[model samples]
Every structure is written in structure tokens, then in C-alpha cells.
Target: MPRLPRADRAADAALLAGLTVADPQAAAAFVRRFQGAVYGLALSITRDPGLAEDVSQEAFVKAWRAASTYDVRRASVLTWLLTITRNTAIDAVRSRRPVPMGAELLDQLIEDSLRSPDLAESAVHRLETERAIAHLHHLSPDQARAVVLAVIGGCTAAEVSQREHIPLGTAKTRIRDGLRRLRAAYAGGDLEVDHG
Candidate 1:
């Protein structure tokens, strides 16, 4: 008998169900399906490769441990998984910071900021995203990659430096210069203007 191809949702749901049952195969499949996405999110938030790896692992472990409690009604498995990953990344970041007053409120604010925007706001956000993507072409290749990694990829200058095999200062300069050029272009100023 030929096996049926599962829809993405169906595949995720089946994997999640397997998770609840402590099925090793399901766990492997689930992790395989979302590792890149989870890691990307963690990397973006932590901006540190080592910390992102830890957070990604912890996020997957937490999801596995609480698999039975997952509510498909509330969110798709991928959405739920990413939310856990994001929260875990946020917590990891906060823990490394010097504790100040209102930490709890800050955490809450960050979580709130991550929530989905409504239709009106999403439309504006989409246009802004489009504009940003368009502006990337005006930057030099290295500068554009650094800017995109730091901004869209959620990487720190250090991460960009490491990834690009360049010195940290060079990475920072590229990102700064790229951003300034982008800002100038958007503001209708001369693109070739250099303050240095």
C-alpha cells in the first residue's frame, strides 16, 4: 500500500501527537522540522550563537516535556514552538543582564511586542518591510549583508563579524554606514554624502 502524503498541518499534528506519547521517532521528526526556524529565532533574539544554541535546545526540550499540554486550538504546532523559543531566548537574555527594577514588566512588554499585529497595522508593517528590502540594493554587497544580518536576521555585530570572517569593528562600520545610507536615501538626501 502506498503511504499518503500528509499536509503540513497534518504532519505537524501527527508529530506533536507522537511527542505526547514519548515516541522517539516523532520527537526526531518534530525537531528536524523546526530546528532551523527555532535556531533562527533564538539567534535573532540572543544575537550570540552559543546562547542561541542553548536556548534552542532548551526550547525543544521544554516543548517535548510539555507536549501533552500543547493546544492545537490555540496555535499551530510551529507557532507554539516558535513562541516557546522566543520566550526562552528572551529569558536567557534577561538573565544575563544586570537585574534592575521592573524586570518582570520589561519581560511582559517584550512578550506583548511579539504578539501579532492586527490587519491595519500589518498592512503598514508589510509596506515598511517591502521598502526596507528595496533599499538594501543601494548598499555595497558586504554592507548590505551585514545590515540584513544585523537587522533582519537579528544578529549582533559580533555575529555578523564572525559569520562574515571580518573584524568586529569592520562589521560595525558596515552596519552603521549601511544604515545611514539607507536612512539618507529614505529621507531624500544625497546618497553619496559622507560625514567622514
Candidate 2:
């Protein structure tokens, strides 16, 4: 391991001592020693001089507040300060991102999703579909058959009724029960279903 310079170690010791006691002189000295590198790291991350300055200031304020938590065993003073600057700069960039969608947008998204079968074939939705299919194993065979026919096979309840040679009500009941059971498997937890 490369050794820290003796003079740098001595300066670190003095700066740490000052920061630990919230000494203004020590804080100033610490800033004077480390400001260039901190600002540079923040600027590189934020890509804006003004934002870099803000991030640097926030990083310094955070460092000052969290000074007592600093441990030389964990990192050198410069390493810790740069970490703070990088994180603060990242947060500044994130803060400038577009605002989150509202509840109306969420509802519209859900409605669009329901009308789009191809959307359900996307990779993420395919994984969710596989998970839902796995959960179908927890259902009774008759119920599972009803759900597969109605949901996967895209059959109406009457078609399921005709195909399964069961009454319309029986087909509907099987689909509803299967759906409710799967819903429970997701929303609740494991259930003891004795199909005997």
C-alpha cells in the first residue's frame, strides 16, 4: 500500500480535530485543503458549474454535520469527502428529472394495459404471467381449467361452459373462484385447499 505523506497526515489530524469540535477555523482550513478536488468531482458528475457549486456546498455542509461519524479506519478524509460530493452531485441531477406521473395517469395506464394483450407479452409481463401460471397450480383442476380457458385461451364464460360441458353458471363460478383463489395466493399467503 502506498503510504500517506507525513505532512498530509499531520494536516488531516488537525483538520479532523477542528471538525470534531465544530471549530470555524478548522472548518475553513479543511475547506481550503480539500475544496478543489470536491468541487471537481461534483462538477464532473453534475456537468454544470452552478449545480456543481451547489452540490459542493451541500456536500461540505453534510460533511460538517456528519463529521463525528467520520472514521479514519473506514476511509481517508479526502476519500470520504469525495464520496459525499459524488452522492450530492448525483442527487442534484436526480432532482432535475421530470416530475412523477399523477394518479390519473396511473389509471389511464392501467386502462390502456387492459386493452393491450401484446403488452402482457412483454418480458416483464411474461415473467409475471409465468408467476401467475405457477400460482394456478394451487387451484383445483376444474377451477384452473376454467381460468385457463377464459383468460389464456381468451374464451368467454359461455364458450368455457360449452367446451367443459358444464352449465353457464358452473363455468362462471369456476372462473371466479379460480381468480379469487389466485388473488388470495398473491394478496394473502399460502392456503390449505383440500380438493378431495
Candidate 3:
């Protein structure tokens, strides 16, 4: 799906805020606006329509709970929602007991193969991801470490600082600085940007 531009994103933020205030029709409008993306992400992760529906509902519930903390400056609404969906799905997957390697692993392997037909294609994707990660390395070591923990490991900045034995402000600075460098690298043509 194509991404919404900045204007649409701001409009979405406003819509969500209105919904939070319990506008009679705001909830319907909010669902109409985001349901497709939410369901699509859930389906992608869960691979089951029923499970996706459940996860989508749960994600929206979580989003509603966290509405007051939504910061448009940090991430778009869609990104934030999808992050919640993805984390929830990952948690769901992890919660399941490990099964024998036969059917499940084989299915996953087949899915991965179908997703990337050839080693070259997979390699290219990996290379691009690595290059983006390398741009993080251009930051100061502490900053790079914080960014890595938050972005790559999916930890919050506070978690990153705790894990790294650093102050919270330091962690925030590192993450912010690292992200700045990453954006600069992308804008300066030093890093290839992939919209996907």
C-alpha cells in the first residue's frame, strides 16, 4: 500500500484525537480510515484471517489506550499503530509453544522462499538493510548502540539505556542523534532508501 503523505498524516492525528474525545461518529471514521492497513498488517503477521481480526482489534484497543502519548513528531499514526500490531503479533507467535520442526518450519521455509525467489534477491534485501544499519554506525558509539537497541531490537529508549547502563537523557540523545544521522545519510545520497 502507498504511504500517506505528511498532510494526510496530520489529518489522521487530528481524527484520532477527535475520536479520543468520543465524537459520536469519530470511532467509525477512525476505523474506516485505518482498518485496511491494520488488517493487512495483522494478516501479514498472523497469516490467519480470524487471528488477524482479533489482533487488529487488540491493536486498536492498545492504540486507544496510548492515544494521549501519541507523538506525531516521533512517528506517523500508521507507523505507530503498525508497530503495535507487529509487536503484538510477534508476542503472539512467541507465546505459542515450540512445535516440532517438521510442518511449521517447513511452511515457514516455503513462505520465505516464495517471498524472495532467489538468493540474489534475498541478498540484495539483506545488503540494503545492512547498509541502513551501517549508517547508524556512523553515529557516536553510544548513540549507535541506543539506536540499535531501540530500532533494531525494538526496545524503548528507556529500555535501551537500562540495558546499556546509561542515563535516560543520554539514551534519548543518542537515539535522536543517531536518527538524525540516519535521515541525513538517506537525504545526502549516502544511503539508499527503500519505501517497502
What local distance difference test score does each model get?
Answer: 0.71, 0.68, 0.64
Tens-digit per-residue lDDT, 1-196, candidate 2:
8985443445665686678788777787788777877886676566689999999999999998888888776556776777677678766765775543333433343343233334424443344445555677667767877776665344578867877799999999999988777667765567456272
Model 3 lDDT tens row, 1-196 = 9986433444778867865776545566667677877786677566779988988898888888787788886656676777788787656644553532233443453344223233343443344435555665466656665665565344567766777688988888878866876767855646443221
Worst 10 residues of 2 by lDDT: 108-117
Clash counts for the predictions, in order: 0, 0, 0
Q: Of 2 and 3, which scores higher on TM-score?
A: 3
Model 2 compared with the native: what TM-score?
0.45
Model 1: per-residue lDDT, tens digit, 135-186?
6656676787777666544467886787779999999999999888976876
Which window of 10 residues has the lowest lDDT sum in candidate 1? 109-118
- In angstroms, the error of model 2 at 41 is 0.3
Regions of model 2 farther than 4 Å from truth: 1-10, 99-196
Each candidate structure's TM-score, on Cα atoms with residue i matched to residue i, is: 0.49, 0.45, 0.51
Instruction: Select the stronger candidate by TM-score from 1 and 3.
Output: 3
Predicted structure 3: lDDT: 0.64
